[model samples]
Target chain A: MQFLRTVLTIARKDLVIEARSRELAYTTLFFAISVVLVFSFSFVVEGVALTDAAAGILWVAIAFAGTLALGRTFERERQADTLKALLLSPVERPAIYLGKLVGLLLLMTVVEALIVPVVGLLFQAPLGRAPWLLTGLLAAGTLGFAAVGTLFAAMLIRAHSRDVLLPVVLYPITVPLVIAGVRGTASIFAAEPNLAMAQAWLSMLVFFDAVFLTLALWVFGPVMSE
Target chain B: MVSVDDVSRNYGRRRALARVTLQAARGEVLGLFGPNGAGKSTLISVLSTLLRPSSGRVRYGTHTADGAGDALRGHIGVLGHDLFLYGDLSARENLAFFGRLYGLDDLDARVTDALRLARLSDRADDRAGSFSRGLRQRLALERALLHQPRLVLLDEPFTGLDDDSALVLIERLRSLRERGTIVVMATHDFDTAEAVVDRAICVDRGRAWPVAAGAGTLRERYRRTLKERG
Candidate 1:
């Protein structure tokens, strides 16, 4: 109960601050929309959209926007120099990691909510076909991304070139999750809609989430200790 | 009681602290007087367990940092050069956030009391970013003490404060000492620090030199230590 309370408190604090500043929200959403617009040129092919480009564009938007959110999340802590205070708090390190992951996931979810429909509209993909499956894929993929992202951002909070360093470190590590996400969504968005293949990819994503979350939780404590 | 036994910390090739030892008792305010890069902040970090000493150890009573774990951290309150208060959050919100992290049960009452201690009850609803340096410093100090830590570590608590703000801080330190809280402060400011420091140690060039009474004023003693020990 105590551990969970600590996690929720951290999430609530981040939410309250973000609510006031709107720093991450505005920056992430704008960047994501811009990404979709820029990529639309390549995938749209003059006037007609590519048949299977929506999945790739959607994940690309998410990954780019997620990276932005992850960077800013810890930047807030570093800006106020409050990261040490959070560390100095009596709560467990995993609770801190989990709280940050939860906040990032929430922010990414909002960005995705905006971008998914935008990608569907622009790319002419069938977003309404598998609403439940699409939500699951997004949730699992986001969890996998944020689980590792939160840990890395926290570790790099004090680095001199953290802004450049974050995505460089984060992207290579999260490629496997992104591949699974892209493949799963691609199957669902396909003309025939391969439900079985999509399910398999979703299962793979869940497995990836468990592994990344466990590794991040295990690694967060020791990494932050130094 | 806090005891640091011959602790040395290094950042790769550069040695930040070298074979230094110190002690502070309950109800005492120990001052670490030093110039910039003299390793006073490094010593404070080692004592706070924010940095691990390459050699030696620090203890709070019978428990070592590793042995006591989070419990040791729980009893420690640190006010670093940075206030660590979120600017977007209101003063009350900042206190409430940290208070929750410390798991204080009577949160509302504690937040109210801390705001009062900070003399920020009037501006409690204002954003911390809008606060003056003194106001933020006062709020930060109260935030650190919100949990009533057994040992308080402060790195330049009087850095940017007016006379009135400095007096409030001095009074608060005296009150903490009276309540038997062990307070350790690192500062270059001698005039203000001299008012509360029960014991003084002059740190220079990553080494700890015990302050021996030299002439008058902490400035004189500090200068004497540097000139004699250098």
Candidate 2:
């Protein structure tokens, strides 16, 4: 019970800061929209998007924007050494990690809510097709991506040139997540929609989320100790 | 009681703290005096368990850091150079947030008392970023003490404070000492520290030496002691 309260407290603190500064929201959202627009030009040839390009473009925007959000979130903590303060507090490290993960999930949900519709409008994809499966895949995939991202971002708080290092270290590790998200999203939005294939990919994403979340929770304590 | 036994810390080939040993009983204030690279901050970090001694151990009562873990940290409040404050949050919100993090009871009353201690009651709703450095430092001190930790480790608490603000801090430290909280402070501000520090030790080249009596002043002792040690 105390652990849960601690987690919520941390998340609430982040949200309050973000709500006031709007740094992450403004920058990440603008960057995400820019990514979608730039891709629309390349992927949509003369007003018609390539058959399978929207899924790739949509996932790419999310991946890039998620990285930006992850970097910025930890950057706030690093700016004033607040992360050290949080670490110094007498709470379970996993609770801290879960709190950060939950906050990121919510922020990313907002970004996707805005970006997904924009992607659909621009690329002429049917976003409403198999909505529940799409939501599951999005949730599981975001969880997997954010779980690994939060751990890495926290670990890199003291490292030099962390901005450049974040993407360099993050992209390679998140390959499976992006791939599953893209394929799952692709199958659901395919010309002749493959709901079964989407379900299979969603299952794979769920498995990935569970694995990543567990590993991240276990690793956070020792890694953050120093 | 806090005991640090022959603690030595090294970063790569650079020795930061060399076989340093010290102990402070409850209600005592130990001042660490040093020049730029004398390892005062390093010693404080070791005491706070933020960094491990490359070769020694610290014990809080009967328990080591490994055994106590979060329980050990629960009783330690640190005010490092970083301040550990969110510039975007209001003074009241900052205190409230840390209060919740520590799971303190009657959070509103505690936060109100803390805000009063910081003397920011009038500006409680003001963002910390907009406050002057002295104001931030005071708020940070109160933030560290919000949990009422048994051991308070302060790294240069007097930095960036004006005379009046420093006096407020000195008075607060005196009260903390009266409350039987063990405070270990690392500061170059000998005059201000002299007002509150019960015992003073000079650390030079990563080695610690207790300042003897018959001193001209802490600054004089610090200079003469380092020269003699050299």
Candidate 3:
């Protein structure tokens, strides 16, 4: 209960702050759209091939855009020097990590929603049999992404080269989750509807979420406290 | 209520604090006055369980500092220069956020009481980002007190406040002391120190010197002591 309370409070606060800024959310949305548009131009758009590639395109968009959004997750905290205050609080450190993770999850969800229609429009993809299932897989992969992303964001902010360092550190570490996420996404698009493949990817994502989030929680207090 | 013996912290070969020992009882305000880079904040960071001591030991209440820092955190609150507040959050939102962080059961009531105590009930809905320096400081005080912590560690709590705001804060700190909250505030401001704290300790080069010989003669003597130590 104590852990949940702290995490919820942090997530709520971040949401409120993001709502007030509007630009932070808008920035990620714009970035997501831009990535899709650029992909549309770069890849062949006139053929049925583009339609078949819709799931891959959407996952790629989310992954790239999420990387951008996650980097800015700690921007306001660092700018206002408010991290010190939060660290000094009696609340558990893992609570802060979970809170930030949830907050990022909320932001990424909004980005995902905006990209879904764009992906359909750009590629003219057919409506898949299990849209909700695809969304569930996306959320699971994102949970794992955000868990690790939050911890790295805190570390990246302190480095002398934040912009270059974040993606460099994040993408390589998150390869398996991304692959699982992309595969899980692809299965829904495939006419065969292989539950086994989707389940395998989803399970992999859940395992990654559990491990990375636990590690992030364990180290986040010591990291943020510094 | 708080005790530290031979406590030290270092990063690589750079020592932040070294072989420091101190103790404070309930209802006592232990002032940690030091110039910049004297390890005052570092020591407070260790005590607050934010930083681990490289060696030695610290104890707060029943928890030893080395292993059970989180256990100690429940009994401690801190007010540093960093308000750690969300700029877009209103006073009430800010207080409620922190209140929830502490897992307070009656969150709304606690937030209301904290707002009133900080004299911010009227502006409870104002965004903290737009607040003046003084108002923000007031809100920061409210944030520190939301958890009803037994010990409060304040780092430069009076830095940017005006005379009136500073006085109000001093009164609030005095009241907390009266309520038996052990406060250890760090500052270089002698006037505010004299105006508020019951006792002062001058910290220099990772060491602490209590001003016990003549508490009234602190302002002059504390200054001289720092100069000599430096």
Best by lDDT: 2
Candidate 2, residue A78: Cα displacement in angstroms equals 0.8
- Candidate 1 per-residue C-alpha lDDT over B1-230 given as tens digits, one digit per residue, 9 for 90 to 100: 79898888899999988889888998999999887999998888887777888999998999998888787899999999999999999999999999988889899999999999889999999999999988999999999999999999999999788998898899999999999999999988899999999989988889998777857998888888889999
**Between which residue pairs do clashes occur in model 1?**
none
TM-score of chain A of each: 0.97, 0.98, 0.92
- DockQ score for model 3: 0.60
- Lowest lDDT sum, 10 consecutive residues, model 2 chain A, at A43-52
Error of 1 at A207 (Å): 0.9
Name the best candidate (by DockQ).
2
Candidate 1, residues A1-226, lDDT tens digits: the string is 9899999999989898898888999999999999999989888976777766889888988999999999889988998789888888888989999988888888899889999999988888888888899999999999999998888999999999999999999999999999999999999999889989999999999999999999999999888887
Q: Is the docking of candidate 2 incorrect, acceptable, medium or high quality?
A: high
Interface CA RMSD, all predictions:
0.9, 0.8, 2.1
Write one digit per residue (lDDT tens) for candidate 3, span A1-226: 8778778888888887888888668888998899888878866545444434767778777878888887777877786666666766667778888888889999999988888888777776544667767777888888888887789988777677887888888888888888888788777667566767887788888899889888888998767766
Report the number of backbone clashes for model 3. Answer: 0
In candidate 2, position B116 carries an lDDT of 92
lDDT of 2 at B186: 94
